[model samples]
Target: MFGKKEFAMSVHHRSARFLHHHPVAQVLTVFSFWLIGEALVRVLGNPLPGGIVGLGLLLVLLAMRRISTLSMRRGAGWFLSDMLLFFVPAVLAVLDHPELFGLTGLKILFVILASTALVMLATAFTVDRCWKYLGDRKEREHA
Candidate 1:
């Protein structure tokens, strides 16, 4: 019964209201889902890290339309806006390893660069495959 535009507007309106009056609830909801995902990972005894598993769970929820990302967007935005703050501790910890910057530093730097390049290449390939699969699926559906 709901038109797509109307449904989208209603979702937007609900999200705005959530952001305005229940921001804490929104944050808690996100945290709770992540916590549940972490629990699932632990219970399954999977090698994958809890954060990654949690993210996968969140992605599934979003894709299935079981949850609206609008509620989490503001809280995520707030955290990302101050993302540098999260890196401060890691940077400081890296400074603690003065030995890593000596002769072996060049080797370490090479490894870092190589690993970064490989990761980028792998991510690009994965994205390309996923895009092609999605495009093919759409074409088949239309046909």
Candidate 2:
């Protein structure tokens, strides 16, 4: 008894709701994007790591509005909350290497600290600019 337009809207709403409720699906969505990036790298022979490529692809899709941020919110939050887990293996690997306790290790530590600070600063600036841009756009649209 539903019209085409209504049916399409209904499906969209249902799927959006499903994504909102299911964190696993959101995570899978993120993983699938990564897989696509890996496939692209293998096919195109790009020098970048697959994870970086995958993130770039995700950024493009987001910027082009092909994907909605709301759908990724929960999954992103989950990842952020447990981000330390991702670095655990690296920490463990460092422990396995005795050479890392010398001056070389100190140099590596300093580089890691400096790079992390730079990345954090850059990310904060970028987020601030993006927030202002979106706010201004919304105001302009309303005016």
TM value for model 2: 0.63
Q: How close is candidate 1 to the true structure, as a TM-score?
A: 0.56
Residue 65, candidate 1: C-alpha displacement in angstroms: 1.8
Top-TM-score candidate index: 2
Task: Quote each prediction's TM-score.
Answer: 0.56, 0.63
User: Residue 55, candidate 2: how far off, in angstroms?
Assistant: 1.7
How big is the positional error of residue 12 in model 1, measured in Å on the Cα after superposition?
A: 15
| Candidate 1 Cα lDDT to native | 0.81
Q: In candidate 2, what are the lDDT values of residues 105-132, reduced to their tens digit?
A: 9999999999999999999999999999
lDDT of each: 0.81, 0.90
Which portions of model 2 miss their true places by more than 4 Å?
1-10, 102-143
Q: In candidate 2, how many clashes are counted?
A: 0
Q: Candidate 2: worst 10 consecutive residues by lDDT?
A: 88-97
Candidate 2 global lDDT: 0.90
Model 1, 1-143: lDDT tens digits are 99999999899788667655666776676677678878988899988877778788889988998667776776666666888997888877768788888978788999999999999999999999999999999999999
